[model samples]
Target: MIEDIYEYADPRFRNLTLPNTQLERLYDGCRWAEGPVWFNDGGYLLWSDIPNQRILRWTPEQGVSVYRAASNFANGNTRDQQGRLVTCEHGTRRVTRTEPDGTITVLADAFDGKRLNSPNDVVVHRDGGVWFTDPTYGILSDYEGYQAEPEQAGRNVYRIDPHSGEVVCVADDFVQPNGLAFAPDGQTLYIADSARTHDPAAPHHIRAMEVVDGRWLGKSRVLAQIEPGIPDGLRVDVQGNIWTSAGDGIQCFDAQGTLLGKILLPEKVANLTFGGPRRNRLFITANTSLYLIHVAVAGAQYP
Candidate 1:
C-alpha cells in the first residue's frame, strides 16, 4: 500500500497518493542515475547514467536498454517545446539537443569567451527558452567527468533565448545549483542548491523565484531545506506541489513551502520526474537504480 512507502507530515498529503500503489524498481546496474525524462511519442523513459557515460531507456513492453553510449556524461535531460531531447552534458561541458532526425545540435557551451564549468541540469520553458545550471562538480572530479579547473569565474544559472540564440546569466550567486523546475503557470520557479557537498555546512535548500518577462527575477527565497541529502532534480505537479529528491527519499511540498509528505526510498534519490501516459506516474532516478510509482496528481503540462 502507498502508506507503506510514505510518511505524512501533513494530513493533506493523504490525498496525493493511492492506498494500494507501491514503489517499483524498473531497472538497476548503473553507477549513478541522475536525469529521467519521458518521451510521450514512444511511451518510453530516458535517463542519464552520469558515471557510466550512457543514457538508458525503459518501456512497459520491454525492460531497460541502452539509449546512447558515451553520452558525454549527461546529467539532466528534458524535452523542448518541439519535443526534442535537451540535455546537460558534464563531459562535453555543454548543453545540447538531440533532434528527432537523430542529429545532435549544440545549444550552448561557453559564455564571455570562457568554457562552462559544466552544465548540470536543464529544463525547457514553454516559451522555447532553455534554462540550465552550471556547476563545478563535473570539472572537480574524474568520476563524473574529467578533472579540471573552473573555466568560468562564477557558477550561474543560464537562459538560452529560443530565437535569438543568445545565452543570458539569470542568477550567479549559487555555490552549486543543482535541480530546477517551473510551476504549471510559469510564474514561479524553484531551484535547489546542493553546495553542502563541498562546504559540509553549506545550505542545502531549494530556492523560489518569480519569473518575469521570461527571465528569473534575480531574487531568491529559500523554499525548503533538505536534510541528509540535497535535491538534485525535481518536477512540478498540476496542483503546484514541488516534488524534490531528498537524502532518503522524495519529499513533496506545497506552494506555501510546507512539507506535505515524503516517499521513503532505501537508496538516496538523485532526481525525479513525472512521466507515463497521463503524467501521473513518477519516474525516479536514484543513486544506482530507476524506480517508479503511481500518484494521484498529474504532472504539469505547459502549452
Candidate 2:
C-alpha cells in the first residue's frame, strides 16, 4: 500500500528514477522518534525518541546506544555553522547547543521575556546565524512533553545571531510550523505547516519564501500539499533537491518544487539528514527505528 502511495514512475516525476534499491530496516522499537542528525567527526548518527525521553546514537562499529537519557524531549537537531550540535528541546521548551567540550548552553528559551512554546526543527545559515521553528506540538499533550501554559499567543519562527545573542522573529503567521530548510543558494527558505491541530480543511503543505537582506521578505507560496501524513523535517542537497520526510516516507523534490522520487519505509519517518564518508548517505529516523540509504546526491556543505 505504501509503495502504491509513493510510486514515482508516474509522469508527474519524469525526471526522477524509482530506484529498485531495497529499503533496509536498520533498527526499531522506539517510542515517538524524531530528529536524525549526522556527526561526521564521530562517524555516527543521533536521533531523539521524545516519548522515551532519550537521544540515540548509532554507528557502524558500535551499533546503537543511548547517547543521552532524559534529553529534555528533544525533537530536532542540526549542526551549527561552527559544527556545534544544536537541538530543540520540547520538555525544556528551549533551544540548546552542545559545545565541543561537551558543555551545554541554552541558546534561546524565551523571547520578549516569555517562554517559547516549543522549539522544533533548526537550520544554520551561511551568514553564521541559526533559524528554527517553534510550535506547540510538544506542549499540546503529555505524550511528547509535559503540557504547560503557552507563554506566547501564537507560534513563530526565529533567527538567532551567531555573533550576538540577538533573537528576532522571522516568520509569525503559520498555524503550526514544523520542518524548515534553506535552498542550496540560501535565497529561499522552505517550511512545512502540519496544521494538524487547527483548520482541518486546510491541507498540510510545504511553503517557500524568498530571503532578502538576511530576512524573509516575500509572500509564501505552496510548494506541495501533503496528504495522509504531513511533512516533518527536510534538508537540501547540493543539487538543490529537497529531501523531506512525509507520512509515507522520505520524498525528494527538485528546486522547482516538482516531486522527484520517494524513499518509502515500513514505518512512518519523522526526520532525516545526509551524512557518511561521502555525505551522500541519508540517515533516517522513522518511528522508533533508524534507516539509511546511499543516494546520488550530496548535502549542503555547511561550514
- Give me the candidate number with maximum TM-score: 1
Cα error, residue 135 of model 1, in Å, equals 0.6
TM-score of each: 0.97, 0.93
Candidate 1 ranges beyond 4 A from true positions: none
Model 2 TM-score, 2 decimals:
0.93
Clashes of 2: 0
In the range 8-48, model 1's lDDT, one tens digit per residue, is 89988889887589799998898999989998889999999
* Per-residue alpha-carbon lDDT of candidate 2 for residues 1-303, written as tens digits (9 for 90 to 100): 135435673354424333444555678878877898888988988899899999888889888899989899999998986778899999999999999898899999999889999999998888878889998988888988889889888899999887898888988888899999888888889998888636677548888888877755476788887755888888888888887888778888777778776877778888888899778788888887888777666888664
